[model samples]
Target: MTSSSKISRRSLLKAGGSIGLLAAATQIKTSWAMGGRSRVGVNSPEQLLALSAVDLSQAIRTGEVSCVEVMKSYLSQIDNFNPTYNAVVSLRDREELLNEAAVADADLKSGHYRGWMHGFPHAVKDLATTKGLKTSMGSPILKDWVPKHDAIFVERLRQSGAIIIGKTNTPEFGLGSQTYNNVFGITRNAYNPDLCAGGSSGGAAVAVATGMLPVADGSDMMGSLRNPAGYNNIIGFRPSQGLIPFGPTKEVFYQQLGYEGPMGRTVQDTSMLLSTMAGYDSRVPLSQKSSPSRFAGSLETKTQGLKVAWLGDFNGYLAMEPGVIDLCEKALKHFETLGGVVEAIDMQYPMDEVWQTWLTLRHFLIAGGANGLYAKESNRVLMKPEAIWEIEGGLGLSAMDVYKASKARTSWYHALDKLFDTYDVVALPSAQVFPFAAETHWPKEINGRSMDTYHRWMEVVTPGTLSGCPVVNVPAGFDHQGRPMGIQLIGRNKEDFKVLQIAHAYEQASQLTRTKPNLKKA
Candidate 1:
């Protein structure tokens, strides 16, 4: 059977009318190009935003745009729309942005352009430490804390000529999918004021969606990048874990579930940032030395004959939103038409076991690292329930518990290997539901099934995170209510380039990227 047909039939049987649930709103009107340069794989307002990163880069290279002008455009967008969305927090020193812009403009006059990123403005997830900048990681405990040096990735960004405009918001300590913090408040969706933007890169998603920034950097531990990208109708990429390095961290939190990557309006833009961010680091032992290739180059790879596996549900715990599965199925069909082969695959892993295994390791690691904060009285007040839960989870985990979980990782890894051996790529809903209520976390109950944990509803991202595979969250389309949804392409570990190539091809073929969300004014 044709892959698309198989998917359609399965989704119709499993999700039924779930796909009919409509999004509450659409994205606001905005310019798709930065300097009259159109982007590839873009069709709608949603796709137009995805073009932001690449368009800005092109404009800077061609001297058709000034870094100052681009920054101002995004700054103005943030000022005009952020109060409604609360996506950006702790903006860079405005004077600093101006000064940086002036420097870039001078380089243009001197004929000393700085490669592809001379004057672009970008932001990172608040969790990434920035030198001399306040990075609260969404907790009141460290609200006044500022680091003395930039995270390795942030420094690389500056060297690449991306003006760091500000830090995006996240849930406390980057734990939940909803973006909110005690210090900076909540970040709402750009498409609908009352809907969520998705987390822990939720703010990054909103910033790109509303044109506040052309491209933003974010981290994913359990689908932060993928979920928000889908939630906000943008592109979020989580590269192979070691592709982007984290350094100068004494704690191994970087090794657990965390991976720093980029989010943008288009796949090309996402690729550009990834290329700039990737490379080797002596400090990060896990880092791989790679001859950096511009991610944009891989977009040229053809998708014909690419093998893909569609795991619409892994053992049935991943429930689909009625239309979400349908839209994603259509997107998969586009892949087939592009000469790719897709097939259904059954994975051998219990949903609860995988989640529990994840929680056990994640909590154990984060809790141990956060011990110092727990000892501090002031920091304790700012500690979130999730943080406390993790701490407690860590405390309760015996050495045997950890060892057992560690042993389980082997089985999970083997299962992933077996699956990858059969397919070049795996497709799944990026998030089971369309953007949920912006005011609260994902529903604890969906269609009467109890979602026992904050992470339970987001099981779709687990496979990628656990396997350390490169996963790209491609915008699918909006449901009836206009809320955005997306599908994920999970490639084998170290196959980051291949994943991007497939997504780039599918993006070009589907024409779904052309759809933009209408920004709702509160």
Candidate 2:
């Protein structure tokens, strides 16, 4: 998967998929090279579950591993771990998935490879609809309602060779960071089954961290991707706005902040998934025109003399749990070691103004998107409090208020834009605190600072969200409790590849990413 487009579509037929076969063979020949390289595990069931998506794809394409073997390994992993972590839900029956895997294997033998994913097993975040699979959105209201059409991203995943096995859990309406709902229950942390997995991409992150999925697809609109990756010790990349076209929804033009992205154990793997997930869609007019295959290119970038701004706690403006800052600061030392200059920078824009702007847009979108539920008294009764709060806030807003909020968002983007003038990337701790207990919803307080709202504790993520830039959550070291943390690297708006490159370099330099969680079972 390192170089997917290496075999051009036209040449794919002429060469009889020889380019992929050669590359796949080479990749299979090399086993699990660390420092941002894909992990190519042995073909046995346990080791097959351990292979990175890229490595697994190569092995499958090259006939080193069968799709049925891969499927059984992952299904076994899910059966073993998912019951306790609940990372995967609405799983299709094992016999059905195995039959599908057999079909994929048959296609492979016929030299009818679908795409880069070529027979890979995958589970989408519960928010995205998969033709026959339940989307639930972590709400009981939609628990049984299966969509006839797939989300734009899901369509691409299917177009590639990914087998849609089931859905990963999420928060109700994806309102809060915590991953729990009456429908699916909690998605526990991959490291500790009792702690928060960090949602709405919580289950996606946990599945990837625990090797239940080779690489997973997730979306980020307020750290749904980043925070969970931080919590689970995996990679979550939120590509720049319009990089991945979002939907075929009713309101396409105004859906600004959130976008689909990828989660994986390695930057290389995430890049491979991103290629399949991105590209222009007519339904999403704002979608970027450039070919997404560019993202799947080599991730080795020269960080020589790169400049990174450490926006730690926003110069004491944002609250942090003890040692969070120190952990990130130590992580930044990797950048320094790579000949990159690191500087502690203060918040360029007013934190309060940014917070207010985020509130306005988030509320406006939630209310408008989920008005179907919020408007009906019956469905409203089933809605979570956070969803209700956001909807109510949005309902109370005037047209002028939304206009002002957009203006404020523009102003914040401009402020961060100036920092990019001197620095290649702006770094921030992915979250203010370590992963907390799954029983706890949102953190009520960080250290001694009281949160004003359910989402206030996760304020560290909003700047990156509001910037509409490319942000990648790389592994920051863990706490004394052995809880994982992530440091986000925010790159220029369209510099998605650059961010991945720098993150790759940092990942290679830092020893943290090499340590996988000692999995705990309930």
Candidate 3:
């Protein structure tokens, strides 16, 4: 096979398209694939967007790149295209950010350079408190809630020299999978502007996908990170719970399931961000110290002979889109080609029971938090009906219900533990389906099976969240509709490096880490 035949994942969209434009810039449309329609922009520049944080970091550190230039490039993209996708919520600190970058450049010139993230532009989900910036949790209740001090993770990023540009959008209180809220509106997919960017980290994924930033930090509870990453054709890593701390909350709300994680265009960048984001925090009692991991440094190593268990549909609770499954299956073949052992395994856990337990706990925590808001009339008016429903559900739950659900969670983890004994990793489709319409929540009927709650359709992610396993999402390949799909690479407990190793190997072997979403104007 010729070098050209070995397609890089970055250019897969152009090469695999019907027109087959290898280097023909004109034939390749620059618009993002949206809702099964490709919007071809007139006079669209041939220059593609999408960059990894690692490369951006190296350029800035070696004086080969200017932080101002980096920030300008992304800021311009956001300015030009963000209105269509609604990916960025609020960006009032442009003057402040540019000033910070100029200072960083002066420092770097004087040999006072900070490592990796120095001067690189990045955004965090609005749920995180950024000092002096409006940190709206997509609810009007906190529309004017500006924190006086930065969250610890935000502080860590700043210490490493990361430029705080703006905050991304999310659902009301980040309670839903969709990114739309009353405050900042909705975030559309980068592939197609009309479809939903899977939330509540949708805006973060879209920002990274559309080249507004090298990477973004987001919190995931349900399928937030994984779904948005898949929808936007990027990598979203939901680290082992407690790896990235969530600061003190009004209540423990979804404490077991909620996690703050990193999203980027490639596996290495995601790993690098995870390293910076992971550490024990006094602020979050649940936070655990990772035993000094080197996720970024180990990306180039060979990962042959890693044991991976490929679970097709999580025992069929969720339906898989045709092309989504086909692309992931083909990507799995690449794993075997890289000398990794792939085996089809039967997960003995009950899907219905797990879904029920997750719902019980999730509703209790979320609604319980909403209870505080319900007491305030103004806050209660801004709360979404779904949020209200959840709180009502939580109120209806008896002490026995909570106890039974907790017990079931323990039992489920033990069952999952037995499978990890035979396999080092478990692979599955990141989302049950591709990016649907911006108006819909999760897909209701998939392959003719009716799903109950908005969260019930994407049950594959529950096991990973419940088990607190390190899950790495890799852009598997695009579906026939031009929408992207991803494969979830799950590793053993605290075996984050192992998952990163395998993802890096597949990323290198397939050479698909560089695929950039064509964000043509609608």
Q: What is the C-alpha RMSD of each candidate to the true structure, in Å?
A: 4.6, 9.9, 8.0
What pairs collide in candidate 2?
A: none
Evaluate residue 247 in candidate 3 and report its C-alpha lDDT on the 0 to 100 scale. Answer: 77
Which residue window of length 10 is worst by lDDT in model 2? 16-25
Which candidate number maximizes TM-score? 2
Per-residue lDDT for 218 in model 2?
87
User: Which residue runs does candidate 3 get wrong by more than 4 Å?
Assistant: 1-51, 250-254, 291-293
Better of 1 and 3 by TM-score: 1
- The TM-score measured for candidate 1 stands at 0.90
The full ranking of all candidates by TM-score, starting with the best, is 2, 1, 3
Local accuracy of candidate 2 as per-residue lDDT tens digits, 263-379: 998898999999999899898899999888877788987878998877788768899998787777766777768998877776545799999999999999988898877788999
Each candidate structure's TM-score, on Cα atoms with residue i matched to residue i, is 0.90, 0.92, 0.88
Against the true structure, candidate 2 has what lDDT? 0.85
Each prediction's total of clashing residue pairs, residues at least 3 apart in sequence or on different chains, is 33, 0, 12
What lDDT score belongs to each candidate, Candidate 1 first? 0.77, 0.85, 0.76
Residue 438 of model 3: what lDDT?
93
